[model samples]
Target: MVNIIAVDDSALNGSSTGRIHFLLADFEFTGADALHNSRMTFFFSEEQSNSCNKRGVNPMEPACPRVMISGRVKKLDTTSPEYEDNMEAFNNRHKHFKIWVQAHHFYLNELEIENIFIVAYQGGPRTIDAEDYYNAQL
Candidate 1:
């Protein structure tokens, strides 16, 4: 199981590299010694266009935003070729199960996280009362 210890969304604008923005989440995995206290950074962008848009649909509207994951976790070696392959596979899975936002809540598959702060460049950041979305089963 995975327990989210903390989430940092303050750097939504500050953590940008060119057009992409990222959110960092801290997690602790139980029932395993190797994956205790791991950190994952989820990369996303407001400017990203949806590639799966139909002919009449506007591609500018963010439909199923693409998210990428990269981090320093104990279970994987960041510098290894296998790590790149694994991350690619993980990201490919998300293409079908995309990260979506609703009412300031971020959902990935069955996990619904309400503490994430979402900000768009056109407006201010919308936030919710901080609450832990923990004990999520893998």
Candidate 2:
């Protein structure tokens, strides 16, 4: 039998904020170490809320999540013959079944995140109250 699994926020916590959520869909695992050389894609979802947006609860447009290539790795002794300084070989030293999220934030069991790019959102602040109309009326 093929058992499929879905990684959702239910496995994480609702109180967490300021971090993107990633879901590891499908694929059944008998053990945490069973995943090896498996390529997976994670999607990031943004939330619009009074605390998140702080712009009068208006929904915000969703941004596309970036994809990163990573896989399981096995620990190696630096003195081993398989060890190399090459980029490709250097990345293949670790082994485990774990989903990565953005850096600087602790990821819960339900949340899996991967960092791709650093984006700076630059713009004037927004307000929900009517300003132009109030000024004109006065």
TM-score of each: 0.24, 0.21
Candidate 1 lDDT, 1-138, residue by residue in tens:
343322222222333112111122223122132236344434454334443353343433444233433333333345766444433343343443225322333212111233445443334544433242233222
lDDT of 1 at 48: 41
Predicted candidate 2 versus true structure: per-residue lDDT over 78-128, tens digit per residue: 364422322112123221213222232222221122233322233422222
Provide the overall lDDT of each model, using Cα atoms, as 2-decimal numbers: 0.33, 0.27
Question: Candidate 1: where are CA atoms >4 Å away?
Answer: 1-34, 39-41, 50-114, 129-138
lDDT of 1 at 11: 23
**Cα RMSDs of all predictions?**
16.1, 17.2
